[model samples]
Target: MQQEFLPQMSSATAFIDLSGLVNLFDFETKAAQAMSNLAYEYVVSGAADELTLRWNRQALDNLKLNQTVLTDVTKPDTRVTLFGHELLYPILIAPTAYHGIMHPEAELATARGASAASATYVVSSFTTTPLEKIADTATQPLWFQLYVRDDREFTKDLVQKAQALGFQALCVTVDTPVGGVRNREQRINFGLPADVVAPYMLAPGPQKNPLTWKDIEWLQSLVDIPVLVKGIMNPNDAELAIQAGVSGVIVSNHGGRNLDTVPATIEVLPYIAERINGRVPVLMDGGIRRGTDVVKAIALGAKAVLIGKPICYGLACAGAPGVARVLTILREELELAMILLGKASVPAIDRSVLWEKPDN
Candidate 1:
């Protein structure tokens, strides 16, 4: 019933195989080429030390989902619900801005794929399309990803706008207080608009101050939607997020873009999950290249998982269809894993299926 293009089982498609046919293309590399062709570099490169970014992917791949035996796997399922909203699959797209840099259709196409696939769309604060227009096109729910505006009033206004537009939740991206130190951008002297660009809130300048919990509280007070803290990795940070009255926590190291040499998101999920004690749902992103990776993440206690670079990769090659293709592979692969593992539903997966890494 789902429409897609899985490139024929040749050199390209064979690389990813059914194990991960959709992600066989390199959206990140293809995108870099497009950006370099378009003279856009500041937004994609990682900050100095770049080690953390590389590790996020490696750490995830290194984690093996210890497969289990013949329980009644006659009918497996992969549906998940988070923040009181149901997601057809546990994988959701991680918010990335400036989609126009990668595809002509950009965010509009992304919204279409996410909508069609029944996955949650976390609209970026710096999205190319206006929030209302994107929300208007959605066949599914929306989550507004917030980047604090110049002042409390301006930030409040953006939150109000998202709420009025019917975005179901607000995910506050906190790790990027100051933009990452991208030496590549410095080498080329690339920079964003010298002034403000957030169309939703006509605030001024590159925001100089970082938002604190007090500011987070202010945001929570202004909107009725549940607030989620994104870009957190450490368990200590997770504890603080719970106390802040936030509804969820997305454990991330900014896909290794923000801090260099931090723990891979996968390496940290268990500790964070243990700390939260299910008080709030824990979601994670970074280096999720396989369906088994999704299985490992939820089994380790991620309420759901998000994909960064991968969707962008698909966009570079095929626009909306590319993103849809990526999600399709992940969804099908997740279902197959569930079927093989005897899980009729996603929530039934747990630690019993995981094997402790000899290395970990």
Candidate 2:
């Protein structure tokens, strides 16, 4: 329990109210040093040109909100339903790997945070904790993220196992046919820490099969659960995902870790949303730091936005309590934004609330 953020923290806390444990930032900054170069890099790595990674934040800066005044928004219902499950809020914990490296608590802690925030947790395929156990720990619904595995049999087995354990959906990450070109993590020669090896990695590397629309079909065949393609940047691919009967598509560039000199996700989302045209839900993840960013993403046609990094940063600082604190900030910030904008329900948000910045 830590409560030193004060005044700014006080106003911020008022949004949804979580204090006494507000120093998740400071804790992560210190935790970064404790981690070996490899562990640190693996978690924090970004790509070449690093421009896309940075732009995730910068592009969000270009958009302006058309705040409505004097509307009756006394109670905003943040509840949203996606992939067949109704969530308390639209926020989902983006799949990040090997939480144990950052803290002993690992994914278990994250599950606790998402549960606390009433947000969904998307567990990474390469998780340090066993997936089933993480699912058991979750108080809220859990989704699974799949890396392209080299073994089709193994992939099928993984999906079956996830469903057996009650995961609600599968998010297949496609941006990394190969892992992202994380220059920072590279500089550190990021590798698994001795104490933090992923048990699943012992199985074998990902199947070298070239993923395509065909793979999506195969994936749908493997399970009854909803399938979401997680790395779509191109509208054509978005269309294909819709045709393949995916329940949703997430617009991500592996958090800008895979490509260099690419446009930020925010730069690509609106067009992708238009192409999909509501056939399948379109979700965005990458550079989302503010509640206003969530609003911007929703108006640009995101069904919901995924959050990464910040929760990990919070975890590095204080474990489950830290992550819960971070989510509190985001939720509060969003609630405040919704209230101020004179909106009362998540569905009420749409393109009308945003004005696009001309690409400079």
Candidate 3:
């Protein structure tokens, strides 16, 4: 039997501290109170008009789960294998930068929280904490989210370092050719505190030079572990990713930050999943707010889902414990949904779970 990994929070609780939180949004609300206005905005805001950002959540809401009772779900299993390690659930902590802005412990706290929850933590290239330090703190699987710098050699060096430090995989972020203009962030003059540092920088600044397919090939040539290309949103792109020999695809729109009006991650997931056709693992992240949301993504054929802003929200609320509480809530909700829907395991969730398919 797989070890029980869900945080035990069924006991009586009052709304006093992080333990009082019941859901991801609850953490988000608490985080807003704990963090500065600028910090909160930076974590939550989307690019340009913010239409895509709002749409991410709206798209998930549009999907309704069809419930089926009178079935035995007493032992419904939530375990899933990704990159050769079994996770307690399909929800992963997406790579968001600069945890220090949310809490003093920074990425280290996030790493510890993820391990406690038995979920994968993809450390961002822009992490305020050193990767080695985060690696030491992690008890579960750790993957590095890479943003290729202008200096190809430096980027390669970072890749080597991550592998040496025991990162299980490399999730290369490809959507950001350039930074998006988040009006909310600009209005606040948002910036990381001076003490926060990106440990992987050769020369600190923005990495504005665009990367091509050749870069992916070079990255793969350097690392023995799986290299999953993040930021894929189109079927054609998914096809290219397969041809390029990537181990997986994360169907993301950079959490609606890189471009406005792009299709929601959920909206584009099925098409990409079809194109990949099980050739590689297809994961997604954008508007995952509930356990039902996780069910919908898996039903549409996502191997797993990554979470970004919510982890920041949890970090800001109460460091590692807050993050664990948020994951516990999500895991419990997913299990409840699974049992209610008559699914025996993660594999039992499919397109049949959806009440009706929304028009693409």
Candidate 4:
């Protein structure tokens, strides 16, 4: 039997108190309470049966930490360097579209929050706010997440504009050639409100021509900034991305929103990392809910990790402060995890920190 869509309290009727929210899930709970059923489903639902979505979190939980004790636990470093910039933490805000649905301030508020947390903010091409406006609000480094438009001229122009607007790198999303079969959204008959629209999307329909490796080469030829391929799940694809002169690769299945039964990003990180062999930075997103997850990812071979829904929850609840709080909790938790693991810095984390089951 098919399950019916359940309606939640409207954002207008719900009130949020950010002070009481202690963790990512806390914010998620509040955000769900404070959003319309349409909005919440848009943010939370995964593709089809959401098998990959559930697995993304479960796989991270299945890995047991091999904690160390009796070491100098003082001054644990959580800093990491990527693309010539020193990030205070290995955590970054994964790009999600249409922030206006969550808050009136939209991506401007997100930029401010990411700056306050000193985290890199990756603005989506489908951003509600203008790229220039987001750049103006950001104090920290910014990266642009691009969805190549069918119109070649517009895509080229957008990349040039992002470079001119001070976006440090290009994260070209490759997994979503077409919209996914989002059952939850379909059940709810969800659509963005007329008032909220993606300003960068000048044309009206879905992209008819999906991007290819040649497009990666074309983008590289057009700009000097580092280009990263997002949505890499296979080891061979990761190698191909490296050979295509990508500066980095994000191991993502579009946050489990593209395909339903694919392996979680965490499950594939090691293989992808191995295939890349340190040629370029390997980052992953999907199912990062705790600091321990961050530790596990680094130990397994992720140079950094990105969070998508958590940031939306924050934005929905308290705007910039909400976003800042989310980053702060993750940062503090990461420090504590490092101290407990006896690893002083992000680079010190390796597979040794994971507990492997003995052969039967």
Candidate 5:
């Protein structure tokens, strides 16, 4: 009773005219028009009532920026360094599943686009393309997003494989023990097309086990590469992850796809960052649509921010070029935001950039 999602165009003819797309939302608008109903729903849908999904953007919108005047802002720097790798901008591509559903080149196209924009690309564990192939295509620093399986050996082997593949970091996702109740996808009976399968999943029997801090500790023991724990929203959990020896923490709510009614990642980011107290780097995702959002995240405490749906939308519109253009737009927007705020560098952003209402 499941419906399979497939795009109409072949990879060779997948290119769409991206001339009119000016921003991320423009890509979203175009992507919705270009993609099949099932594919678009899969990209945009969140869990249950989707309150958290809506709040992600709403909470960011509620935050007001306080700009300064009469400061020399001739040069604006958007560079950020994470785990020793310097990114041209603070924006990174969040790991998302089933890129093949959006475009024919799949993760290869995403990798090329991220590399073209000089941004870090995180490959999802549920990637349609093989990790080795993605690594081969990516010119920028690559990080592998891990969803630990019930089988400990399988999880261990996957970690080793990613390390061997030259992935710079292992981003272990710890939030999704079970799938979310996404009504939209459920309404469509969404299922992947036959040709699009996660190559790493071919070996594991089935992942039934939820990840634990102990598992994260074990993962750290396996390889010398830095292991980051993604899906952290609670401050206590962020503290625990650092104690467990994680190199970094990514504050996320699974893009509001895993749990409904949870606070937006942006809302909880400051608490997590405060708890970490600069002991380790903090990154966040969800509800980042503009350069101001990136600046807001940096000001609050995020070392960098990852974007999910926008990248998929870009891929759906015009393959690699669309993806690159999305990143470029965000970078330029962030640069402009920084210049207007009279902040010359990424590190110059702080709580002072935020406006607080006066008490009566």
Candidate 6:
């Protein structure tokens, strides 16, 4: 199957310009044409068997929405304030590694695009560009995603650099103790370029003592900015993050790239949100492609939704403009969803908008 796709890509030369694309799926199709086979799979594929990958979409599709009529929504507001920064919408660009694979501009283009859309960009630790450059280039809010190195001093230096550069928050990725078994990458023997490095990393792979709850506490102590722990799935873990002094929790399964067969981020979302019980903001990623998905997430108690693949697809298709278009489409979709559902503002969304599908 992979071989067939590669051959088809040989005739995929004429790039699909932004004007020709209408949705994320369209962008993804065009991107597949634009990128090399290995690069495309690395950005898009999930873990072994990809069951959780399929389930992430299935869970969102399984849920139903309850609409209200006869309520005034003359001016529906999609604005949100996250960690003291106000965003035009609740959609954030998820921190995916190696944007350079998709476009020449890489993280710089993404930062510019996100800033153009008035959205937040969570710059990945495994970035192709330097951290300070992205921070300096970004006009919108920037948050640094930390993958602590084996050396404690190196980790502290990275944290302090982010703080010094005016990064608003620290997003500690907690799931990747060791890299997951990405079967697609294995099949293609995918590896990073020799030039791409973490810049601050003192070692090659995951650190020896992969962060614990104590590490979370220690991370918080190192910086004055809000710290959000990403890669949480279980309610117990979410509770533990709060106890560890995290400012927020991102309920993700590493975009279905880690520990296959775990419940979809959407499947575990409400549970984690319920357990957190308003103690802190709960954001989620994985299988979020539509604006309605954003609305459903907020109704289920997500303060916002982080998007990964769509951003990749957008970059692949038309570079920075493609990414900005992706955000525009989703934002429009969310605002429309809100207005149609009689939600006047982000604060008006709640579980009341959700309908449980009847047991068969």
Off by over 4 Å in 3: 1-16, 201-209, 357-360
For residue 137, model 1's alpha carbon misses the true position, in angstroms, by: 1.3
Model 1 / residue 135 / CA error / Å: 1.2
lDDT of 2 by residue, 271-315 (tens): 999998888889999888888999999988898999888878766
lDDT of 3: 0.86
Query: What lDDT score is found at residue 91 in candidate 5?
Result: 93
Please report, as a residue range, the 10-residue window in candidate 2 with the lowest summed lDDT.
1-10
lDDT of 6 by residue, 1-360 (tens): 001001111122235446677767788888898888877999889999898988998898887888889888867888898877788889999999888777777888788778777789998888888988998888888898998767788889889999899889999999988878888998999877665554554445666776789988999999999999999998999988988889999999998898899998888889999999999999999999888899888888899999999998887776667778888888877877888789999989988888767699
Greater lDDT among 1 and 3 belongs to: 3
- The true-structure Cα RMSD of candidate 1 reads 5.0
Model 2 misplaced regions, further than 4 Å: 1-37, 202-207, 356-360
Say which prediction, candidate 3 or candidate 4, comes out ahead on lDDT: 4
Q: Where does the lowest 10-residue lDDT sum fall in candidate 4?
A: 1-10
Backbone clashes under 3 angstroms, per model: 1, 5, 0, 0, 0, 0
Tell me each candidate's RMSD, in Å, in order.
Answer: 5.0, 5.3, 3.6, 6.3, 5.6, 6.0
lDDT of all the models against the reference? 0.76, 0.79, 0.86, 0.88, 0.88, 0.84
TM-score of every candidate: 0.87, 0.89, 0.93, 0.94, 0.94, 0.92
Per-residue CA lDDT of candidate 5, range 1-360, in tens? 111122233455455666688889999999998788888999999999999999999999999999899899967978888888888789999999989999888898888888877788989998999888988888888898998877788778888999998899989998887788889998999988888887776443435565779889999999989999999989999989988989999999999998999999999999999999999999999999999999999999999999999999988887787788898888888988998999999999999999998696
Q: Output candidate 2 Cα RMSD.
A: 5.3
Candidate rank order under TM-score: 5, 4, 3, 6, 2, 1
Give the per-residue lDDT of model 4 (tens digit) for 1-360: 111111222353235455687789998999998777788999999999999999999999999999889988778878899988899899999999889888888898788788888889989888999998999889899999998878899889999999999999999999887778899988999778999988786564466787889999999998889999999999999989988989999999998897889999999999999999898999999999999999999998999999999999988887877787788888888888888889998999999899988798
Q: Give the winner by lDDT: 3 or 6.
A: 3
